[model samples]
Target: MNGIIIGQFIPGDGFFYKVDPRSKIAGIFFLMIAVFLLKDIYQVLGALLLTFGLLIIGKISFIKVLKGLKPIFILLIFTFVFQILINRQGNILVDTNLNISLINIGLVIILFVIWRFLAKFKKFNFLLFLGFLFGSIFIFIYSSFSFDYNLTSFNLQIYEKGIEMSIFVVIRLLIIITLSTILTLTTKPTDLTQGLESLLSPLKKIGFNSEDFALIISISLRYIPTIFDEANKIMQAQASRGADFSEGKLKEKLKQVISLLIPMFIIAFMRSEELADAMESRNFVPGKARTRIHELNYSYRDVLVTAFTVVFFAVALLFRLNVLGY
Candidate 1:
C-alpha cells in the first residue's frame, strides 16, 4: 500500500510537467489503447521503450515506478501462469511423464517449504530467478524418480505459444501501469481536473455537467493520499494496542483488519462532512458556472506535443494492422 504511486503528485520541472494537462491526458489515453492493440512482441517492446523514454524525459525514478508495481505483482504472476496453463496451441516446450510416489511428494513439499522461506528475504529479483530455476529442476528430478508400478501417473506439457502469450500479457500490463504512474506523478490534481473539464466541455451541449464530473475526479484524486495516510495511522495505533495484522491466523487477521477499518471509515466520514460544510459556506454549488484563478492556455509546445502524440498513435495503429510491417 505504501508503494502505491497513483493519485499522488510529485512537484517537478520536467518536460511532462510543462506540457498541457489536456495533452498529457489525451496522449496517455491513446498510448494505453495502442498498448492493448499491440500484437507483435517487437511492437510491445517498442511501446515499452517509448514509455521508458517518457519516464526519462519526465525525470521519474525507475525504482519508484517498479515499486508502484509491487502491489499488483501477484496479479501479474497469476495472469502469466494462468495463460500458460490454459493455452495449448503451440509446439510443446516441455512434455514429461511423471509417477506419483511418497518420496516425490515429500520432496515436492520440502522444495515448497524452502521456497516459502527464501521468498521472505528482501532480494526480490534474485529470489524470483532462483525460484524459477529450482522449480524447473525440481520438476525434472521428480519426474525422473518414476516407479514402474505407481499409485498415479501424470503428464506435464508446456507450450511455446502459451509462453509467448503470457509474455505479451505481462508486458502489456506493465506498459499500461507505467504510463498511468507517469500521468499521476507528473500532473497535479487541480490541473487534471481542469484539463478533464476542458476536454469534456463538449458534453455540455449534450446535457452533461462537465464541471461536476471534474469536481468528482478532483475530489477522488485528492482523497487517495489522505485515505492512505489515515489507514497507516490507524494501523499503527492498532499495532500499539497489541493488535497483530502482519502475523496471525485468518480469524485474528480479520479481527485486526476490522479494528483498522472502523476507524478509517469514521475518519473518512468526518472528513467528507467537513469538506461539504466548507464548500457550502463558500457558496459552492454543483452545475454552476465558476471562474478559475488561472486559465488554461495551449502554447506552441503543447501543439507540437499533441501532434507528435497523434502521429505516434497513427503509427501504432498501422503497426497493429500490419500495414507498417512491424
Candidate 2:
C-alpha cells in the first residue's frame, strides 16, 4: 500500500471525478499518443504541460503523481545519465568519460529531479546517487574493454528501434499512469463499473456479457483495498501475537512470513467461496435481461474530449511521419 498504490482513490466528486471514467480512459490514450509522437524537445515539453494542466483541472495533487513515480527513481537516474553521458557529443560539460565530472549529465539529472521529484529532497538525492552509480558502472565496463572507440563492442543507431528514445517513452507512460490515477481518483467506482457495463453492451453480441464485465470491474476494484488492508492487518495481528519480523536474520524472518502465508491463503479462499455462493444465490447469470441503474449521458465535455483526442492523434501521426517536423 506504499508508493504508487497509496495514490489510490480517496473518493471525491471533484470536477474530474464527475467526468465519466470512459472519457478519462480515452483522454489518457489520446494524451499518451500526443506525447509519444514527439521527436523534438518542444513537443515533449508541451505535452508535459498539457498533462499537468489536466491533472490540476481534475484537482489531483501533483505530489500524488510524484509519489507514484518514486519507485522508479533508479530508472529515472539511469535514463538521465544515459542522456547526459552517453549522448555527450553536443556539449563538453565534463570529460568524465574517464571519471565522473559535470557535463550535460549533471544538468540532465537536474531536469529529471525538477520534473519528476519536484521539491522532494529524498527522492532527488536517491535518484542522483542512482544516476551516479549507473554512470560509474557503465564507465567501468566500457573502460575495461578499451578507451578507444575502435575497440567498442556494440552501439546501435539511435532510432533503429527507439531504444535510445526510452526517456521520452517513459515520460509518455507517466502521463498515462498519472491520468489513469486521476480518473480513478475522481470517478466513483460503482458509477465507473456501471458505465463500463453499458459501454460493453454491444459486445454482448460477440459473447461478452455486460453484467459479467461489470461484476469483474466491481470485484477487482473492491479487492485491491481489501488485499492491502488484509495484509496490513495480518502484519499487525502477527505483531500482536509476538511475531517479530523487523529483527532477526533475514532468512529467519522470511520463514516467519512463510508461516503466515497458509492462514492468509485459507482466509482468502473462504472469502472468495462465500462471494461465489452469494452471487449464485442471487440468481446472477450472464446475458440476463438486467437494466442499468444509471444511464450514461454524454455531455459536451465528452464530445470535446473525444474530438481533442482525434485531433491529437492526427497531429501525432503527422509529426511521426515528418509532416509537421518538415
Model 2: lowest-lDDT 10 consecutive positions: 151-160
For residue 197, model 2's alpha carbon misses the true position, in angstroms, by 4.2
Q: Mind giving the per-residue lDDT tens digits that candidate 2 earns over 1-326?
A: 64334335666655666666677666765676666677865566567777788877767888877877777766765675465434523333333333333433444465556545544566476556656556545653344323333322343223312334455656765766676777667667677678667667789788878888787778876777777778788888888988887899999898879867867788789889998899879987655776656776677778777787787778878888988875
lDDT of each: 0.82, 0.66
- lDDT for each residue of candidate 1 in 173-251, tens digit (9 for 90 to 100): 9999999898888888899889989989999999988888888887887788889988888888889989888998999
Give all TM-scores, in the order shown. Answer: 0.78, 0.68
Q: Give lDDT for model 2.
A: 0.66
Off by over 4 Å in 1: 1-6, 98-100, 124-133, 140-143, 146-151, 219-277
* Segments in model 2 whose C-alpha atoms lie over 4 Å from true places: 1-7, 11-14, 88-174, 194-210, 223-242
Best by lDDT: 1
Candidate 1 — what's its lDDT? 0.82
